[model samples]
Target: MAEIQVNEDEVQVGAETASVCPACQALLSDGTIQGKSVLYCTKCRGLLLPIANFLPLVEFLRTLRRPTGSDIQPRDNSDADRHFTCPQCGKSMTGHPYGGPGNVNIDTCESCSVIWLDRNELQRIVMAPDHYPVYSRYDSGGGLRRTN
Candidate 1:
């Protein structure tokens, strides 16, 4: 992809892509978040990421995040009712609360294997405290425990 520097953190890729922003109806522009290529809406600041890259991208962002001592914001139940179509496959995207700590509402297009995140949703996920089970060497049973 041909890339032009939009700033230190974002790059604008060649406009050969047909990805359209589901929320804003604008042409989705190519950009990199934490060095990962993603299509983003300049108007709505929404993001489209492949499902396979979702976890890895979250992990990558987590490494760079600093604890903010803030609680994870409540999930927006309203967004769970919103509908959107996939920019890639033109299929209806399934909207649901993300099964993660951030309480984010996400849209997934199974046929396209892609996810749609609205503005600041990615940041909310990365900033949410760790809630996954953690195994400690101190525990002989290898059971899960909360560190935070």
Candidate 2:
């Protein structure tokens, strides 16, 4: 009797991916039981893989997060959602519940192309220093500065 063999490459490996992307909310399945971590964005084709044990790759992975859109435009919230006025743009911010590391809840301003990250939302994006620049005032020569 001959045993049937299966090719790993012939299989579609994405459907069983465990986690979903924090930014786009897409599946990130291709997993290996966490001997290490792989952070990838299927929609954006961004992949983050750790090299060895406890390397700095995770830090780099966390920093890989970038703004997918300038702002998430307003929508009907009759489905029970929280609202916030963007500190950067003063627009009613519509938030999305994020389930990544810190579980950041984020919102955006459509009028001014600014994002409103609630509480520790920035931490989930990147573990580097959290320094967000807000531009509301114009200086003498049209330069930008952080205001109080």
Q: Highest TM-score: which candidate?
A: 1
Residues 77-118, candidate 1: write the lDDT tens digits.
Answer: 877777898999898999988888777889999998899988
Off by over 4 Å in 2: 1-80, 98-102, 127-148
**Each model's TM-score?**
0.76, 0.27
Q: What is the lDDT of residue 86 in candidate 1?
A: 94
Q: For this target, which candidate reaches the highest lDDT against the unseen true structure?
A: 1
Worst 10 residues of 1 by lDDT: 135-144
- Backbone clashes under 3 angstroms, per model: 0, 2
Q: Write the per-residue lDDT of candidate 2 for residues 84-106, one digit (tens) a residue.
A: 55433455755664333333454
